[model samples]
Target: MVQKAAAILMIIILTLTAGMAGRQENEKEQPFLVQITEDDPSIAYVLVRMPNPVGLLPLPTEGEYTRTIRQIMPDGSEAVNVLHLTPEGFWMEAANCKGQDCVGEGMVTLENREERVLWNMVVCLPHQLVAELITREEALAMIGQ
Candidate 1:
């Protein structure tokens, strides 16, 4: 009889454990998509979503504007015109990480699948911050917004 009682207790414990594990899994799967929308005409809204707990960060959106942001200079090297794109337009600026590799990045008007894959890819120079736009899905899962 005592053995029977012990067996039942073990089963109950296992069930509870399983239930808790399932809940955890569900929570982990909840946040997986982030959406960046055009908020104020002056400022763009970058909405990020991630699993519960991970929060979102508001990035500053003020930089230089130029048609030839990233370009191939007369020298065989590259040149980046450190420009930050906002709802208003692109800002003409320069990053500290001089050189031309980033400038050779060409122009990124809209984010393509290839660009999205390159999210979080940027070389922060002492004077400039080069960045790429993350996809909605990636942003969601990244920030848990």
Candidate 2:
């Protein structure tokens, strides 16, 4: 009985150690992808699907208009966002967040997708809202290389 228990424990220990090592290596190798930015013909949009009932509809990237996005939280709280889409980039017109961090993120008008993939993100944490921007090449790669 003692030997059997020792063998089981040894297996468990080795399994846990291997899992942790793999996780560390995976984290190091992972490349960060940008999550959100204004509409651009060359860029692809990634909208995260959460428990939230509503989502943003796709709009033309080459137009000039103010888009309003209303998100009602699961807890019955309300969050509102007014966004302006221009030919150059996108920016927040107004929001109802406590910190206004999402509105303060400013316009994400990056021209270089290769270099800015990791930095372009618009996160409204309080409202559980996030937007991600992926390049056209990345989008194609996601489908199939």
Candidate 3:
């Protein structure tokens, strides 16, 4: 009788562990957010959320694309940055800033954001622009979405 109870307990524990693992996997699949801000108080901020890839599609879709963000400075100069997004991660493909430091910041992915030097943000100080990777909850709170 005791042996049967132990077997049942083992089975329950295994099932719970498997369920937790599946939940973690689903969380991993959720999309991340990107917030872009211009230092100038006159210009409005921009927040872009990366879209999750469409499932089971034979061909590629909006899940991967290049987004060009242009911010006009008070002096009428334009700061341009090209952001590249993939299912795996996102990176600054190109920037028109003189320093070009943002381009060198490399990729920010779910797997590596924590370990990165800047955490989840890339900054273009010369242009007074910042691009940051943020969680969905934070994004919602910021925009009241």
Best by TM-score: 3
Instruction: List per-prediction Cα lDDT, in the order shown.
Output: 0.36, 0.50, 0.52
* TM-score, prediction 1: 0.31
Error of 3 at 52 (Å): 26
Model 3 residue runs over 4 Å out of place are: 1-62
Q: What would the per-residue lDDT of candidate 1 be over residues 1-145, giving only the tens digit for each residue?
A: 8577556545533543454464433322112113345461222222221111112223334543222222223353433333444433222245324464554444333344245333344333422334544444555455444
lDDT of 2 by residue, 27-126 (tens): 3211122222334344443332222212232323666666544444567665666665555556666889898987887665545423543365566777
Of 1 and 2, the candidate ranking higher by TM-score: 2
In angstroms, the error of model 1 at 145 is 2.6
Candidate 3 — worst ten consecutive residues by lDDT sum? 51-60
Model 2, runs deviating above 4 Å: 1-61, 112-118, 140-145
TM-score of each model, in listed order:
0.31, 0.51, 0.54
Largest lDDT belongs to which candidate?
Answer: 3
Query: How many residue pairs clash per model?
Result: 21, 6, 0
Of the pair 2 and 3, which is ahead by TM-score? 3
> Lowest-scoring 10 consecutive residues by lDDT in candidate 2?
27-36
